[model samples]
Target: MRVLIAPDKFAGTLTAVEAAQAMATGWLEQAPDDEVVTVPMSDGGPGFVDVLSAALGGELLAVTVTGSLGEPTPATVLLHEGTAYVETSQACGLDLVPPERRDPERATTYGVGELVAAALEAGARRLVLGLGGSGTNDAGAGLLAALGATAQPDGVLASGGAALAEVTALDLAPARARLAGVEILAASDVDNPLLGLRGATNVFGPQKGVAEERRVTLDAALERFADLADRSLADAKGAGAAGGLGYALSLLGGTRVPGIETISAAVGLPDRARAADLVLTGEGSFDFQSAGGKVVSGVASVAGEAIRPCLVLAGQVLVGIREMRTMGVESGYSLVDLVGRERALGAPRDSLVELARRVARTWSR
Candidate 1:
């Protein structure tokens, strides 16, 4: 039997490559005779550059850039041909800020702009930015600022929705000239709009540490930014992703495309899974989001078309067997339930491997 293992990163626990290795080890221990192939995957959020770089050989270019907190940090971008892949999370990811200091109002994407500048300086003709895991709701104002674009100073130029109220002007001439010939692609997984209740501020503000009472203020701020940009936030799908970074990229001539679709096509996942008897996939949590165009769902869709049973192993499985069955997942397993939540949370890698081995043993029988 040919088994294909393709799983996303276990969020804060393990990377996609690490998860694939653990799964492969367990499968080999239990099903020694079965041919197992590992294909690490991401939703074009965090770890996108690393996963894509590994799958398609690329050179890693590291440059010094500012962090979300305005501190200087080293950020890496993947260079493939004339196109440079930049994962914004490397500069402004939520993980970089501590829980106590996790205020979206204070974070900035200036570092992301720096990354783009570095890529441009390196002679990259095109830029692919994975926009997710962001800690700010600046609507890419800070990013533009870093790229030499002018914006209203003072008040809140970096933080949550309230900051949008202070924006008095926008000057993109510098950025336009700097990136005149470069094509920018803003890869995102979410389809949230830019304004209103379902827009960037209202939908993602709380998660980024915006208080409930402050949501409306932030939402309105994003609305103003959208207006200033001469674009209707509500009309753009994925405009709310990365805290209105999608909208910012759109104004900057960046094309917004389904992250999973882009990654899947780049990695040739569908072609590989077509020849496999069983395709294994997973994520941090297998919930409704999995069905909403995540990597796992994307892989399952392809596997289903090829008539292959797609098995799943998650860190925590919220969806039951019946729910997952509808998405072409024949069977689902969870490390949290198998090893107990405490143990599973403590050492995810070992727990995941053991759970995979146990599942493989069951398959062998």
Candidate 2:
């Protein structure tokens, strides 16, 4: 029997590649006669560049840029066949900031702009930017500023979302000039707009430390920035991704593509699933949100299209078996369920290995 293993990053615990390796190790231990193939996955988040590089064997260009907290940060841009792939999380992801230091009110996307500038300087004619897992909520004001979009008095947009309310006017011509003729793909799975109830601040701000009371103020600041920038694109799909970096990309004429679809097609997941006897995919938590445009659902969909049996091996499985079937998964196994929560969190890789080994006993022939 042949098994194809694909999984996304386990949030803070393990990377996608690491998770795949752990699963493969345990599966092979239990079923030595079976063949296992690994294809790590991402949904336009932190591991976007790494996964793409693994698939495309691209040249990684290292660059230093401003981090979400206005500090120097290191990131990589994957250049392949004149197209550059940029992962937004490397520059401004929530993982970059410590929990005690997390401040969505002041975080910025300036590093993302610097990354794009570096990619352009490397002679990339087409840019594919993966957006997700950001820490900032500046509505991309800092990114625009880094890309040469200036305010009337200058330095008005220097700060993050907190300063957007003070902006009187914006000049986007310079940024447009820099990106002219560059085909940009804004990759993301989020569909929330830039502001309002279903928008960036109201929906994602809490996770990044935007208190309930401060959400309204921060959302209004984004509204002000949008008013000065382009209000029309503020309500566009994925505009809220990476804390409104999607909207800024729209202002620069970037086309939106679902992050999963972009990465899935690039990796040829459908064909791989078709060739496999069993398909395995997972994430940090397999909950209701897993059915959304996340990595697990994306992989399950591809397996379903190929008429293959898809199962999930996650750190924790919150959804019921019925919901798992609805998401195209035959069954779901949880690390937390096999081992206690303490061990699951302390030794995630080992816990997953044991869980996979146990599951293999029942599933593998």
Candidate 3:
């Protein structure tokens, strides 16, 4: 029997690579005769660079850039041929900031712009930016600023989403000039626009520590920036991604690509699934969101295309059996359910390994 194992990062406990290895180790231990293939996956979030670098041999260029809080942060750009792959989360990821110190209104994406600049300086003519899991809500104001766009009052649009409310005008001519003749790909799965109820501020602000009362104000601020920049692109799909970094990339003429699809094609997941007897994929939580543009859903789709049975082994399974069926998953298991919450949280690696060992006994033939 042959088994294909693929998984996304289990939030803070483990990266996709770590999760895949743990699952493989447990599966092999339980069924030593079975063939196990591990493929770590990501949905253009935190582990985007590392995953792509492992799959596609590339030079990981190290660079220092400004972080979300005006501090120097170290980041990397994967240079494969003339294309540079940049991960947004590397610069201003929410994990970079502590929970108590999180302030979405004041966070900045200036470091992301610096990362782009570094890529360009390294002679990259094509840039693919992986966008998600950001700590800012600045709508890419700081990014544009780093690329040579200027606010009328200088410091009025220096940083953060709240500062956009005070902007009187912006000049994007210089930024446009700098990105000329470059192909930019915005890799993300989020479809929300940049403003309104379904937009960046209303839908994602709360997660970044935006107060309930400040949603409308921040949304209006982004609107104000869009009004001065490009109002038309504000309603475009994925404009809300990475705190409107998608929209800013659009302003710079970046084409949007579904992150899962991009990674799938790059890794040739369909062919791998077709060759495997059973397919297994997972994430931190198997919930309704897991069915939408996530690694688990993408892997399940690939497995379904190959007429193979797909299973999920996640940290927690929050969806019902019906939902699992809808997701094309034969069954699902959770580490938290198999072991207690304490073990799942405190010893995630061991708990996941034990869960995989148990599941392998039933699934492996």
Query: All predictions: root-mean-square deviation over Cα?
Result: 1.9, 1.2, 1.2
Q: List the residue pairs that clash in candidate 1.
A: 105-159, 105-160, 161-218
**Residue 153 accuracy (lDDT) in model 1:** 63
Following a full C-alpha superposition, what root-mean-square deviation does model 3 have from the true structure?
A: 1.2
Q: Candidate 3: how many backbone clashes?
A: 0
Tell me model 1's lDDT, rounded to 2 decimals. 0.83
Q: On residues 1-365, what C-alpha lDDT tens digit does candidate 1 reach at each position?
A: 88888899998789999999999998888889999888898877889998889788888999988888888878899999788999999999998888998878767888898999999988899998998899878788777777777767653445444567877887777877787878998888888888878887788888888899888777777777777776654468987789878877777778899888888887888888888888998887889778987878888888998898888899888888788888889888988889898887789889988988998887753
Error of 3 at 195 (Å): 0.4
Q: Candidate 2, residues 25-110: lDDT per residue as tens digits?
A: 99999999999999999999999999999878979999999998888999999999999999999999998988999888888898
User: Any runs in candidate 2 off by more than 4 Å, and if so which?
Assistant: none
- Would you list the clashing residue pairs of candidate 2? none
Over 1-365, each residue of candidate 3 has an lDDT whose tens digit, in order, gives: 99999899999899999999999999999999999988898999999998888778789999999999988999999999899999999999999999999989999999999999999999999999999999999998888888889997786655799989999979998998999999999989898999999999999999999999999999999999999999999999999999999999999999889999888887788988999999989888899999889999989988999999999999999999999999899999999899988999899889899999999999999
Q: Identify the superior model by TM-score, candidate 1 or candidate 2.
A: 2
The best candidate by lDDT is: 3
lDDT of 1 at 123: 89
What lDDT would candidate 3 get against the real structure? 0.92
